[model samples]
Target: MIYGVVNLRREATLPLVVGNMNKQQQVIDTVIDTGFSGFLSLPSSIISALDLPWSASDIVTLGDGSETLFDLYAANVIWDGQYREIYIAESETEPLLGMALLYGHRLQIDAIEGGSVKIEAL
Candidate 1:
């Protein structure tokens, strides 16, 4: 299996466009939530600011309880390093990198020798 990991810093939240029905949603910070099972977690304020359109979806897990926040969409793909669209999502979760992303691209993670996280693409 091709596996890799990257050193994603909180300060490096990617800025991309998101929405449904071809509408561009708000630009929010998307943290690399490898711990959780969601693709992206849009804060209540961000959801309100973007005026996102959503319906009742399956609740996603945060830890002990479910997340009661913005709606989730089918973001099966995202902007690549060069800003190219790529399919990634396979699992449905709130603001997280589900198995789909980790296994879809066959990526692996490891500790960097110099106090950094390394992501290797297979």
Candidate 2:
């Protein structure tokens, strides 16, 4: 099981450890974005700091229905006590943890500031 917390903004968030091929890693606070169907999104600064390798670029639709191209990078992430390789999209917004990363897991959120957030494997 993975444990997290709801922030003051009421967003369900999880702290994730993201790494590069060289083993450089950083702890990132990621907001849980159910509307996102991909794996993960991180800011350019973090990506640069980690020196994540570029994979490809793809156009993605935003929440406001606008389309924009995003640069994708290969990253290693520690999720639920396991090391997993996943794609990370470059975004200017706060890091986002999407449904792709949450698939096969049960998510429970209390929906309030300082509330508990939990993810249990199926």
Candidate 3:
């Protein structure tokens, strides 16, 4: 099981421990965005800081219905107590935990800062 807490902005956030090929790691707070279908989205600055290697490119539609190509990177994240490899999309916005990462898991959020949030594999 995984646990988290709602942020001041009322967003459900989780702690994601990301690592680069060199085994360097950093723990980041990521917002859980159900609307995003990708595995994860990290700010370009974070991607650069972590020195994640480019994996591929993908076209994604934005909330405004505009399509844009984004760079994808390969990185490892401590997920559900295990180290797992996941693809991360480069974004200028806050890091997001998308549906792909939430697949096969249950997410519960209280929708208030310091509120209860829980995630667990089914």
Candidate 4:
């Protein structure tokens, strides 16, 4: 099971172990976003820091109903005790853990500041 906590902003933030092609790893916090269907969305700074390779481009609609093209990158994430390849979209905001990453897992959020958040494989 993976553990997390709700922040003052009421976001469920979880720790993620992300790696590059060379296997260099970094542990970072990512907010759980049920509205997003992709695996992950990261800022350009994180992408540059990790030296992630570009995979492709995709068109995604925003919450504001605007369509935009986004860059996709190849990334490896440690999920449920195993390393897996996942596509990460480039964004200018905080990292988001979306529905694709939550697939096959149960997510529980307390919805209060400093409250408990949990994710476990189904």
Candidate 5:
């Protein structure tokens, strides 16, 4: 298991937007999941703010034995002292960062354990 001190941010919800594509702006919230697998989620309030080109085409399985459709988009994220461009799936509402990105990042929950996890960029 990997362990490290991570920087977390509570992003503000903004409309989905692709400022570089020269397409219509998509307003979306800024709440990015540190461990999220590329997806954009928002409340109705947030979606209403955007100029959606079309509905999302992907379907995601939920934890409650159900499935829901999520929106997907290309987003630019600045984190861990670096900037990255990733595709984010859209949802109505969800928590920040899931385990997928966490595992990919090799992040470990560091408490006071003697064999705590620490991560450092090379």
Candidate 6:
């Protein structure tokens, strides 16, 4: 099981440990975005700091129906106590944990400030 907490903004925020094969790692707070179909989204600064490798670019439609290109980067994350490889989309917004990463897992959120957030493997 994975544990997290709801922030003051009522976002189901969780900590994600991103790392590379060289052992460089950083724990980032990410908001769970159910509307996002991708795996993860990270700020450019974090990607630069982590030295993550460039993967590719893809067109993504925004909430406003506008389409934009996003740079994809190769990354590894510690999920449910195991290391899993995932792609990170470069975005200027706050880090987002999307549905692709939550696939096959159960998510429970209290939906209040300082409330509990839990993710369990099926």
Better of 2 and 5 by lDDT: 2
Query: Which candidate ranks first by TM-score, i.e. highest?
Result: 6
lDDT of 4 by residue, 1-122 (tens): 98999999989999999999899888989999999989999999899999999999999988889999999999999998899999999999999999999999999989889999999999
lDDT of model 3 at position 11 = 86
Q: Name the regions of candidate 6 deviating beyond 4 angstroms.
A: none
Candidate with the larger lDDT of 2 and 4:
2
Instruction: Tell me the tens digit of each residue's lDDT in model 3 across 23-121.
Output: 988898899999999999999989999999999999999878999999999999988999899999999889999999999999988877799889999
Candidate 2 structure quality by residue, lDDT tens digits, 1-122? 99999999989999999999999999999999999988999999999999999999999998999999999999999988999999999999999999999999999999989999999999
lDDT of 1 by residue, 5-74 (tens): 3333422223345554445444433434556554455545545454445544665555667564435544
Instruction: Identify the leading candidate in terms of lDDT.
Output: 2
Which whole-number lDDT from 0 to 100 does residue 119 have in model 5?
31
Score candidate 4 by lDDT: 0.94
Model 1, which residues run further than 4 Å from truth?
A: 1-12, 64-77, 81-103, 106-122
Please provide TM-scores, in order, for all candidate models, with all chains considered together: 0.47, 0.97, 0.96, 0.96, 0.46, 0.97
**Model 6 over residues 50-91: C-alpha lDDT tens digits?**
999999999999878999999999999999999999999999
Model 6 lDDT-worst window of ten: 15-24
* CA error at residue 38 for candidate 6, angstroms: 0.8
Candidate 3 local distance difference test against the native: 0.92
lDDT for position 57 in model 4: 100
Q: Which stretches of candidate 3 lie over 4 Å from their true place?
A: none
Better of 2 and 6 by lDDT: 2
Query: What is the alpha-carbon RMSD of candidate 3 to the true structure?
Result: 0.9
State the number of backbone clashes in model 6.
0
